[model samples]
Target: MRVADVGEFGLIERVTSRLTYGPATLLGPGDDAAVIAAPDARVAASTDVLVEGRHFRRDWGSARDIGHRAAAANLADIAAMGGTPTALLVALCMPPELEQSWAEELADGLAAEAATVGASVVGGDMSSSPTLTIAVTALGDLGGRPPVTRSGARPGDVLALAGRTGYAAAGLTVLSRGFRTPRLLVEAYRRPEVPYAAGPQAAGLGATSMIDVSDGLVADLGHVARASGVAIDVRRDAFEVPPQMRDAAQALGADPYAWMLGGGEDHALAATFPPGVDLPPPWRPIGLVAAGSGVTVDGKPYTGSAGWDHFR
Candidate 1:
């Protein structure tokens, strides 16, 4: 049935009824506002919006895929701050002609992704719009640890990364060209595998600065550089190009490094730690923070687009 058939209240009930709440959620959906626990007395909150056509295409992904992507975008931000996600507030605006089942699937996707990090969909709002939009606000707990920021990196810090990069961008390229043979790349674009645990782990290991790699690595690192008043030099050789990426690159005759360096939406975590600290599995040293400003690759300026920009 079409969303209009159920109307607004019905749609809300259908979506909220299927959600499962956790201990952190004191008051869930059907309430005016959600009351989430903040044992640390501090909340790390982040919000992100996904718009149809611009952020996603219905033909390219299922409602669930978009739902997962929407949740990850915000959850990763909380993780980047070295906090554990507690709850999410999702606001969905869709055309009335959209299928009701699609919206249900979207809720399922949001709940499933939140469950990965032990979070829950506490509340949200629904509205009718000419276009489909998913806006999510995620709250997290610091657990008494100081929240990591982008301005803490020092000249002697070790630059590190947690999770894959460029896979989503590569997948975008493949899908844009009308071929999905490289299922790995396509799936990466569909649902990013965010290293949620790595954020708190890095914080526990004394991460000086951290960020979610929603923008391209260089672009996001540029934010860290400017904020910390330091320069970041990434080793091109440090990135390991997977065979799938290489095959896709060869097929399209595109530079995988461009995607790796400048692609966004993978939601990986980039952090800087004190020198001599040992990085655990999945967190590898990618470069170093130095005494200058701006981000560079192999000691030279990056000529390609650093990352995604909403407006040119």
Candidate 2:
């Protein structure tokens, strides 16, 4: 049945009926607004929007895949701030003819992803539109620690990474070329495996600065460089190119490093630490911070487009 057949309230009931709440959610759906607990006396919040065709394509992914991507985009932001995600507010705009089952699946996807970090879908809104759009707001608790902002990195700091990068970008390339034999790459593009725990872990380990790798490693690090008044130099040899990525790149006649350095949406946490600090598993030293401005690769500015630019 189409969403229009059920009307607004019916759709809401169908979506919320299966959702599970976390400890932080005092009031969930069927309320004016969600009341979430903030035991730390502070909350870290982030919001993101995904538009059909522009940010996603229905042919490329299922409604659930889009839902997971939208939630991860915002949740990872909260994690980047050294907080634990507690709740999510999702607002969806879809065409009247959109399938009712599609919306239900989308809600399931959002709930499943949130559950990974012990978070919940507390509340949301629905609207009819010509295009499909999903907007998510994620709330997090800092656990009484100061947020790891982008401006905290200092010269001589160790630039570290806590998750895999470029896999999604490589997957995107494979999909764009009308090929999907590499199921792994295609899946990565559809649903990123975000290292949500690494954010707070890095904060505990004294991360001077941190950011989620959404807009590409070099571009996002450029934000850190400008904010902290420092320069970041990423080592080209630091990345271990997976065989799958290499095979996809070779098939597409593309440089895998370009995707690794410039691809976005993997949601990997990039952080900087003080010298002599020991990085835990999954947190590896990938670069260095210096007394300068801007991001570089192997001591030089990256030649290609550094990352995604919506306007460009």
Candidate 3:
């Protein structure tokens, strides 16, 4: 049945009923507002919005995938700040004609992804709209550690990354070109795997600066560079592009390096560490921080476009 058939409160009941939460959630659904425990007495909060045809396409992913992506996008931001996600607030706005089942599936996806990080959806709101939109706000615990912000990189710091890059952008190309590629690549575009632990791990290791690679690696690193007032020189040979990304790029007669440098939504962590600091297992050195400005590839300026922008 359509969402209009059940009304907002009834739909909320159906969606919240299927979720499983933890002790962090003092008061969950069916409350005026969710009360979640902030163990460190400090919470790191971030929000993300996904709009139909802009952030995603219904034809490209199921409601579940859309929800998962929404959760990942917001949670990764928390992780980027060296925090562990504790709870989430999701708001859904959709056309009245949208199916109730779709909303439930979206809720299920949100719950499952949040559970991966031991977080729960504490509260949210629903509204009728002309289109589908998902807005997720994530709250995290820093565990008494200082947040790893983009402004901390030093001139002699080493740049590193945790998790894959360019896979999602390549996946988008594959689908657009109608090329038959590995399911993993396509799924990468639909459901990104964020490195949830690396952010905190980096903080524990004295990372000078950090950010989730939501935008392209170079683009996101540029944020760190500009904020820290340093130059980031990425070593191209350091990147180990998976064969799937290469194959997908070849199919479209496009450069895989472009995707690696420009693709966003990978949810990987890019961090800057002291020159001699030992990086944890998940972190791999991909570049170096120097006294300058902007991001460069192998000591040269990157000429390609700098990742996704909400507006031109």
Encode model 3's per-residue lDDT on 1-312: one tens digit a residue.
Answer: 999999999999999999999778989988889998899889999989998888988878888988889999999999999999999999999899999999999999998999999999999999999988899999999989999999999999999999888888888888777753678788998899988999899999999999999889999998999999999999999877787777766667888888888889889999999999987688999989999899999888898768888875
Kindly list the per-residue Cα lDDT of model 2 for residues 1-312, writing each as its tens digit.
999999999999999999999898999999899999998899999989888878888888888897888888999999999999999999999999999999999999899999999999999999999999999999999999999999999999999998878988888888778888588778888999999999999999999999999999999999999999999999999998988888888889999999889999899999999999999978999999999899999999999668887766
Model 1 stretches astray by more than 4 angstroms: none
Model 1 lDDT per residue over 102-156, tens place: 9999999999999999999999999999999999999999989999999999998
Best by lDDT: 1
What's model 2's overall lDDT?
0.92
**Error in Å for residue 222 of model 3:** 0.9
Measured with C-alpha atoms, the lDDT of residue 75 in candidate 2 is 91
Q: Residue 148 of model 2: what lDDT?
A: 98
Off by over 4 Å in 3: none
User: Which pairs clash inside model 3?
Assistant: none
Residue 12 of model 2 has an lDDT of 99
